[model samples]
Target chain A: MIPTPDLSHLKASDYETVYEPAEDTFILLDALESDSDTLKQLRPRLCLEIGSGSGCVSTFLGSILGSSEALFLCTDINPHACSCSVATGLQNKIPLNLVNASLADPLLWRLQNAVDIIIFNPPYVPTVADEAWTAQADRGIGGAWAGGKDGMEITNVFLPHVSALLAPGGHFYLVAVTQNNIVAMQQRMKDIYGLESQVVLRRRAGGEHLSVIRFSKTLAVKTAVFHSNTSNNEVL
Target chain B: MVRLITHNLLACHAKGCTSNNFPLQFKDVQIVVRESEFNPDFLRGFIPKIEWPALVSSSRELGDTSLSDQLPEMLDDAFLKTLHRVLFEIHVEEGVMICPNCSHHYPISNGIPNMASSVTLLIRGLPYLASSWLNMKLANDLKIS
Candidate 1:
């Protein structure tokens, strides 16, 4: 089982992180547990953690969720991030498939429209400059904290791919910070690929708090279903 | 490099398109429909942000309309199923999309679109097209440099 994250040494500002257990692990668990649907829907099978910072999120989910039931595919654009996450998953005995893949690559993996639950704890601290970007936070955002500037960069690129990877009736839980242009960011989220969203969790610390937004994919319209046999020939 | 899905995210509210200047029409239409799996989760997650009228109409124009005119009151199993096919399954293989606003045309051939516009002409018809054009550049960077 994953070691429960200790929030004793951390503050809200710590949430703008780069794969530290002090921050990410706590938030992921909070996001999963507080949200009933996220907790229930993400039970088993293929789980894709898009930005597996240090693998804490995936490892925690794999261990806490029961490793044997679901397999975790931990992916990251940065090699360092990928190694860290992979190391954690391996050390924790979590069922993880570690890969160095960008969120936007269609050919990165064999999972083409076949993932059950999709999760992203992307680089919400957005930045547009490469020079100012951190080597650690280069998952996107150029490494500086400018929440709105680059939050959607990954979202926009990865949004379409989520449609191609998510299994039917799957759930996608992505978290981002709303420092600026929250309305525009919210609108962008709403408009892309038809995600219904809600801010389930928020933290207030050091005069700044982050909100956790969860989005789920609904079943398509009735007209598209054809006759298929399933006592429960569950195709997910 | 523009995709229809990207197109649907756009509206024609440029400098001059005020009346009936919407549902950017696709011209010189050529399309390529590629089969990508239907991830209902993503689709379901995506519905709220969709401009219902825009998505449904634009999708229909491309001959794959499935979403209702109004955002359906119920996200029924049946509705979700149809939405799966229309939103996720039906890929825009080929077509030319024209903005109903500035009469600008964005063409999609081989599942790729020519969203390139000169700086001054970027706002000629649809500013949304500009973003879509930038996205196409990013997508192109993924391969075929």
Candidate 2:
């Protein structure tokens, strides 16, 4: 197993302004690690991580795809997190390009149907919409977890853009909790965006039942189910 | 700092400025090129995704005239190496990226771009002491130490 990126460069004071790597961050890393072979097979050219706090996840991805020509682009609302991401990338010898912007705004049109891999471990904590908006507006550590109204407000804002952002055969990995109604999210993505999804990993951490769902564009749901059944029958 | 891969994806997001916002113009740039390990296979796969004209012009703006104005039909090893250098090595450490249509200036200093400068307010109205106390406790609980 590839070890986690060295984040020793980040001091405690850095965490004061940035969202420190926690359970959510670890699960995202684990999901990536588990899918490393598949990801490498995808031969991704551009990998984008929204809400890349402390640069841990991106750096870990950098480690997996190591010194390749693949561009590891990261965005964070918190400027401090962007700075930390740069520092972490430097420390780990991973060349990470960080844009301190909210949820891929400036990147939309240009990046439309271009990004090979997109990952978002957004603010999935349940909170009032006003508080989440305030945190988002603040662009501080508060923005890390002040997810509004069922923890889907921020995630919801970014969802519609996913279908637009993904390249052909591109994959998107999102971190969510039970409160976010995972089934509804999957159904919504299927109905609206035609992005088929399946739960990749799940773990109960403290109060949050965290799950990482992986979505792909234009994947026919019935075909996947039929294919799985055929393979199972073949094994039998 | 802006890299070609980033510049390739950036467009002006200033309100009410819509069309032709792509390929933001670089101005008064101080570029530092840091050598990175070249991976030919990766670059070979990535070439198709590039906005060739934008990259060529942006690299030219950064004072690296290594890449041709057009994407070469044939991508050789030497050419891929140059493409890799232009895309990954050159960093716009100190500069302003002016929006093509809106004229919004995104500044880069100390190797990090201040893209969120428009929203400059941190969580407000709380006493510094109380906020720090809360942040510290939260950080510790999150095992940020």
Candidate with best DockQ: 2
Q: Mark the regions of model 2 whose C-alpha exceeds 4 Å error after superposition.
A: A219-236, B117-145
Model 1 stretches with alpha carbons more than 4 Å out: A1-18, A22-25, A36-42, A104-112, A128-150, A180-183, A221-236, B1-145
DockQ of each: 0.02, 0.27
Query: Candidate 2 at residue A65, lDDT?
Result: 80
Question: Taking the tens digit of each residue's C-alpha lDDT, what string does model 2 give over B1-145?
Answer: 5777788878777655677777888898888888878888888877777789989898888888988887888888889888988987888888888888778898877766666643422221122225545766897989965
Q: Write the per-residue lDDT of candidate 2 for residues A5-44, one digit (tens) a residue.
A: 8989999999999999999999999999999998888888
Residue A174 local lDDT, model 1: 69
Residue by residue across A150-227, what tens digits does model 1's lDDT show?
Answer: 444435445555654565566677665556344565566557556566776776644445666666566661112211
**Native contacts recovered, in order, as a fraction for each?**
0.00, 0.53
Evaluate residue B65 in candidate 2 and report its C-alpha lDDT on the 0 to 100 scale: 94
| DockQ of candidate model 2 | 0.27
Return the TM-score for each candidate structure.
0.49, 0.87
